[model samples]
Target: MNEQHTVPQAGRRLIGLYPARYRELYGEDIAATFAEATEGLTGRALLRERLDLASHALRLRLRIASTDPAGRILAGAAPIALALGVGESLYDQAWYVEDVIRAVSRVATRPALAAGTLGAYAALVVPWIVALLCAAAGRWKPARRAAVLGLLAETAFWELILGHTWQMYGEFARIALLAALVLLAPADLVDTGRRGRWEVTGLAIGAGLPLAALAASDATVLGVFWQSVPALLPIWAFAVAAALLLAHLSARRPDLFRAAGIALGTVPWLLEQLPRRVPTVWAATAFVVLIGGAVALGGIIRLLRRAIDTEPAEPA
Candidate 1:
């Protein structure tokens, strides 16, 4: 005698949570399993069978529909990109804060200017600091999303509320470049597993960036170091060659592309520091925009190429 099969209403409802592709493929099999397992069951046994069916069906759905490893890696990178962009802004604001404090300490300053500076720092810097804290706690994805939100908030504040200029575009481009770097860095280099070390390292760098800027700006410090250090052109060339060679061997092109972009971006700053060169503002801005665009574009191209490689081959 054949047994009549009937699916519990609860079981059917739970299975519907799965994707349409999953349902189409495995829905009948799951329902049958649930019916057989729950047969001759009363209160507790029937409840347990239903729960098991729900979990097993969900697991199967996930296993079948999961994204490829490359896609997963790229998705995991969202936080880092968000954090880097936010951190770059914070890095700039740290210096701005110090400058404002120094101004307050040194000479009588306009109250409105000081207030505005402090407000800008608060609006822009605090959220990035929070993002760093979140990352330190091993919350990568959420932290980055929050940081992006904060960035958008600040950008809106400057653009609509306070207003911005073309000169500000250079600063915006620098932050964009930082985001591009995080997005474009080789997946292996990200090290998302080590929360303690990564967090500490990131925080230390964030704290030190402003100090490094101050040191670079000081005439005495520059004079002392400028004479001792060789020009960057040779070092830059060697670094690029090394990056290219490593990328060729490892098939890891992201870092190589990023390094090239950074090298391009550094030209204007390097020229500004050179004693002989008086870099024009418009020229420097143009160079920065181009470098930022190049870096961002390179990242997009790499991502697209990876996507193409990962796509399933068509049947002959």
Candidate 2:
């Protein structure tokens, strides 16, 4: 047993350079891994490989703490890559399991999806990590009109051309929407644009176009691309926009519910006419709509409660 794990002190020291929290759990195991790496090593290349592992760990985890430079870059670049990958995957429909495995590497987070979303999350996150690196260097720059147009084209085209099956295409649409969110970044940060996106996403999800989607169906409309980029972006953007716009509107006209107003304004007219046209599966789509409406109304009430909690209460 001793000879099998005969890890040298310098190699162990290198691995042990990891954080204490991580080291306590993995230090011994890593020492064993290095012992294997150094099996024939007495050269500069060997030393370099050992240092590279430590360098990779440092670059990935130990940078700036504020605004999560890594997260930002991931958010910036990942969405487009996801759209491209899924588009490619669709292009290459014939799946070898090895290829399929590589394609959906981020599907569950872990190397394998047998565990759960946490693992899936890890898988989905690699590209976003790259995006975060890009964002760390500079701001995202894209034209708004062009972005909106690209989104419309992409979503509409996919909606039309995708195979007729509901399950596969539904996931496709949701993933496409996520791609749109990642792609549709604001023209500029108006101020300290740290937060305000949920309201925007809520607006998108709850406003006019929702009628089109009100009719429930089996398909998810969300294919798992390298999904993190497209998935969290709009919500993140929404948080930023909502915080800035609402803060300004509140200071200028507190009674107007500017957040809601902006949200309503952002809706497209086609969505407004969605309710009448939505196809019913159960003949009780109307009931589903009603239940959904009630849930939406309940959400507003909860938001009010949160708002009131933060406000100065009057003397009883």
Candidate 3:
């Protein structure tokens, strides 16, 4: 095939990956632009063009690109989700530290484990605090850098410092998903107007809740409260579900965008359940059922609202 023919062909293949509605509307123009952009380009330049086309198509299919409202909501929700996930991890780490302390009191010879646990906690916590501060102050570029560094530190802490034989594969997957969401979210959308303030507040609240729980328990001298840290995950998940249901029921028109954004935020917690040895299949099944039911419930509520709005009222 001629060079001219090959570029257009490659562009068409990439465009075909888009949703049918999207492809039908803009496919030809995108293909032509891709060809024009890649004309006379070769090696890395040509490869870069192709990759960009593919990435855009993938984003459109995912409905998480800036072009879609859903994308904007997801972008706005990403930082909040990141904060929640980090906070949950820190809460777990606090429990781990408590366990280590208890073990040391019993054995009096695990100084290394104690030191390693504290080191790992610091590695994860310090950078995440910086990220949260940067994000709150609207310094997104620095926030992104700090977030990435925090994740890397946590990964190293697990793989090198702790040297645990077993890995939490689900936790790793959740981390990767969080990183993608944070990196892919459009900063312009995430840091604009009232939405930005809400996002920052959500981040602070999401992150602060777990720490506050820890502090409350510690200060009150209540071992039961400390033991209840694990229960907070389920409580958070239930609260999100309740909020979605209430939003759907209470609104004249259900806000699917907000519901979806909330759902995306809870995904990290859902993912954390996946690697559990017991009830693994049940966890996966429950997640699918929960998502399916939410979508169906939203559709039903929308249809009902439309019907009510269209119905004629009786004359008195």
Point out the worst 10-residue segment of candidate 3 by lDDT.
226-235
Tens-place lDDT per residue, model 3, 1-316, is: 3333445666778878899998777766776677779889989999888877887788778877887886776765576566665565555565656765675675557777766656666777788778767777777767777888887886676677567444466666667777777766655556534555455556455555656575546743244654334334534543444444445445676556655665676566556544564444544455456655666666777788898889999899
**Of 2 and 3, which scores higher on TM-score?**
3
Task: Please identify model 2 stretches exceeding 4 Å from their true place.
Answer: 1-146, 149-156, 159-192, 197-257, 269-276, 279-316
RMSD of each: 13.9, 18.6, 7.4
Q: Across residues 130-202, which tens digit of lDDT does each residue of candidate 1 receive?
A: 7677666666544555565566656676577657776456445544543443333333334456743363345
- Model 1 C-alpha lDDT versus the unseen true structure: 0.50
Clash tally, candidates in order: 0, 28, 0
Which of candidates 2 and 3 is the stronger one according to lDDT? 3
TM-score for predicted model 3 compared with the true structure: 0.58
Question: lDDT of candidate 3?
Answer: 0.64
Q: How well does each candidate superpose onto the true structure, as a TM-score? A: 0.42, 0.24, 0.58
Candidate 2 lDDT score at position 147: 34
Instruction: Give the C-alpha miss distance for residue 38 in model 1, angstroms.
Output: 27
